[model samples]
Target: MIAPMALARPSPQELWEMDRQHLLHPWTNFGPFEREGALVITRGEGCHLWDAEGRRYFDAVGGMWCTNVGLGRREMAAAMAEQAERLAFSNTFVDVTNDPSARLAARLADLAPGDLNRVHFTTGGSTAVDTAVRMVWYWQSCMGRPEKTDIVARDHSYHGATYLSQSVGKRPGDRVAEFRYKETGIHHLSAPNPYRRPEGMSEAQFCDALVAEFEALIVQVGADRIGGFIAEPIQASGGVIVPPQGYLRRMWEICQRHDILFIADEVVTAFGRLGHWFASEAEFGVVPDMITCAKGLTSGYVPLGAVIFSDRIWQAMAANGERWFTSGFTYSGHPVSCAVGLKNLEIIEREGLLENAARVGDYFLERLQALEALPLVGQVRGRRLMVCVENVADKATKAPLPDGVNESKRISDAAEAMGMMVRPLGHLNVMSPALTITEADVDFVAETLERAIRQVTDELVREGHRIG
Candidate 1:
């Protein structure tokens, strides 16, 4: 056994100095990081995390929506160590394969909906999405329709950071750096955000309008030139924007009639985050042609991602004879990562985490919904364990907080002081705790958020901001 080592640990000030001088984090402001440095989390166990200074805080965001099984599981650590000792590395190029990878693929095929039985492994969610888009283009080429290469994605949808994946993604904040493919044949459709829908329109009508807009785009762009329509069942990073009821099903129907492939980006929704292994068909009644998943596959114990596709695409490639489908990563089916993923899935099933998420998620969301009664809260929405709280200056108009308010960040900061952590996205605070969270944990989260928002609201009022 690889037991824990009792090495001398750095003090909080030393750690902060090291981080400030070295680490360059992702999606960081730089200005603030230069002044404040990183948070320097030291340890995590179950649903809580401890910083370098030994301060404990509730992990409400689940480690960027990936830690479905929480942290510090000895079984998961043991599985990883065992796999590394046995067979740490192997390339899945051509016919080469490993036992864990093959077994995990078969298991994922069984859990996936419809004929999505084929699996292509990658290092993480970005690469998984990149593989899915590449496969779509390759499938079109194999069908002898090379012109069908354009992809349709929705505004505010976050796919990944790879070139092809980023090209298809349409997040405004991600694009501010002006780094993107100049002409990637990617198109955007309106987001089906019910809270921002046209005034006086019912949810059903809003759904219809969004579908009609998609249809119009297809007609204008010509379905013959479009290869795929990629979407997240619930847009997590984009403020947890859940589409109107029946919206995903209707979109799938249109894609079916137009011969356009549908790719469900379930990176944040898969592996018990939404009370299921995959949420596409189970929650939304849509079996996409391809489903990209990662994050909770190993419950964030290790880095792993995969693209699960229907047999139709596999059969099409098989029909193309000896011509190779030549695209893969160096660590495609990494033995250690695959072993950890399999063990993670085993833990989730054995512990009844899925059932717990379903039962407790209802109470969680119900508690969050009650926060809408607060003056600064415009909306609280989510499904299962994934939820978002949108801040607004006026509930009557659904207007966002003032230009420089940064309400979400203020609330998050306050919540951290109150012993909880929540993700701040623009004017929204997002939360997706581990599947192991209980009703008692839910109560802590709700109470902490209420206090945080109330404190921020008071600050805004004193600062001369005209907030609700």
Candidate 2:
């Protein structure tokens, strides 16, 4: 039997005060937060969240684009609790191992495509990326090519906030303000963005240009000196950029020709966010030397991440028997996290959530695109449920709103006021609903989004703000 609901909790004012006084929020300006209370969310279920006041809103952000199965799955919770009670704190420290860890490793090997058979566990995406970086260096060292230590990533790419991951990501304004920025052959490539193509060039021509640029960079940098090239399959935090047709394939060919390792950062795109187990395999049809994934692995049940190593990488490491990669987090293969991940994967397979994302995703995309008729929407781009609406000042000129003006934030705030949760990624309003979302739920998203946009646009117009 389901447990009875507890009585309503204390007011949000109390919680906010507690948070400001005691909690150190990530990536926050503490001074502003001290003056203004934090957003105190209390509960979540399915595609909805309830604040301390019990106010419900559609969770369009999916808890930072991770919770693909949605909120409050008792099954996953039970699995975690059960594992915690049974054998919670075991370590996978080379010699010692746990059942859940071994099982999860095997399960990931089965799920991953190509010869990605070896699983190296980490705490989350950042650590996974860091692990990949270390592995690349180690592989080079093993192959007696220790000089091949440089990495290449695309502009607007987001790997993570760790030392090496941040070094690898080329996102503007994401640079470490305090640390010295390294320029160790980490080349940047122009993304296959068709909207901002070269003058008088079609998308096909633009794709060719981007490919040529990357290939030339590989030669200029001397491919022998570079370890690998890494990128998100569809740039998620990079404004949900869906590359031009044939773009990913060309990049793959370039990497192959240069003998540079290819890495797919699938942290945000894996596990049905884009209607696929692995977005790289499903969308681009390209395999990589290593794949990093987290976020949706356990659908936010517990902290988990992985670096899936291919057979070649594994063999190289194994060949150097005494000199294994000495890289692992203390909680890398936490038993509870592994058990929860196992259960979560079973849920995805049993419920066919991957297929569900594909089936219902078209409706979501179509309805989101329908919003382009609005003057405030400049573009709608995504695959499956991983969607984005880029706000522009003028559709004809494709100009953005004033810099320092958070138009996407304003729209998101408006949506929240209208009882829907939306997230602003720069000037782009984005959503990645639970993979289990229904057609009716998608319809509601469309209707509610239209309502929010209309309200915000009308207000902006009243304020005499220029908007597309």
Candidate 3:
């Protein structure tokens, strides 16, 4: 047989040109894309990434808050390869099953809190959330309550990118592209952002007000018209806005009273991100009716997402004799992805990553808290590894930096130049480093971020922004 043609390894310039020509990146600013092009990251290993030119940078964003096991794991690779060779693609449809998928479902059930045992695997977070929405509608329809079809979502909460999922999402910028489903039965409430609460209101008062608002909405909208409420334990994409104390629990109580299904979108907070397999009940003391999770499920090693629902949903379906859910994906529970998930879970357990996240994440936040002393830092807030540093023009007034200042972008650019990566969300810089991160890694991140913030402060002063 003739030897296989050798694979071509494109040079850095060639790679960059190819990306600029063909790749359409997500959440991209086209103007900047046309001007600067994308950074071609070639490889990653243990909380760090290397660009095409072989420059190393600390992955403070944890590969978009997913790479909990870090990167470049030989075991993860081996598991994927082995599963692919054994039984890579199998349709997990009616009368069909795969070993990895079944096993993982059981494992997740064991790990999940309460009766969140039924698992519906999807290709990624968006689809998982889409599935949850579909199920809510389906369940309501099946129960002969089609009128109770509206979904309640919080402002600035990110569920996913799918049409239905994005319809439920309320990020103002995310809606600028348009084409969202109009007449979609979705409602929104104010985000439980304590920092932005009305002046003279304590955090406890803010929490009470938010819960009251939720209850009032339910009453005003008529609970008979509401089917589900979806929220993130921590609004990850919305500048890591941590809800006030008792917010989630109180919301769940209202949902219970209103006969509404509560869906905790744990896409970013699950699977060791918050030092737990699931953060809904573990971190927030709320056992939601459903939890849509992805990201750290497979530690960014492969694409996999799941919706873990309570037995009430399962029982409803079971009680409906001969009625099929009639929803699934061609690659739902792909054996390779499931196998990788199993191995990822195994790695997390064996390596004690959960405990590591808890310990190191606390230290990391403590170190980042020091940055609040900086003039531009309005607040530093987070739990475990997920954190955000909000930039402000006036700290005492808590006024946001001028949009033209591009404060977060400037800080992210400065950090990148100094060998670190952080996500720039408007006026905030968000970070969710790998669970494998160490105290030393936290030190590096803190130092780099401090330097970046200081540099940006100087630039802002030079630009005459009059930051205080």
**Whole-model lDDT for model 2 versus the true structure?**
0.86
- Give one digit per residue, the lDDT tens place, for model 1 in 1-468: 754435756679988997899888888788889988889899999999999999999999999899999899999999999999999998899989999999999999999999999999999999999998888889998888899988999999999988888878877678865564735588999988999999999999999999999989888989899999999999989878889999999999999998899999999999998898899999999999999999999989889999999999999877948679888899989999999999999999999999999999999999999999999999999997999999999989988976578889999999999999999988899999999999999999999999999999999999887776
Evaluate all candidate structures by whole-model CA lDDT and list the values in order: 0.92, 0.86, 0.91
- Clashing residue pairs, backbone N/CA/C < 3 A, model 1: none
Each candidate structure's TM-score, on Cα atoms with residue i matched to residue i, is 0.97, 0.96, 0.98
Give the higher-lDDT candidate: 2 or 3: 3
Error of 2 at 121 (Å): 0.4
- Tens-digit per-residue lDDT, 1-468, candidate 2: 744435644467767787888998866666678898578898999999998877899898889889988889999999999998999798788799999999999999998989999999999999999999888888877877898978888888989988788888877667656676667757778766677677789988888888888878767878889888898998888788888898887888888887678899999998888888898877898888899999999998799999998999888777937785689999988999999999999999899999999999988898789999999898898888899998888998888877677778778888888788878878889899888899998888888888888887888788888877
Clashes of each: 0, 1, 0
Decreasing lDDT order of the candidates: 1, 3, 2
Worst 10 residues of 2 by lDDT: 2-11
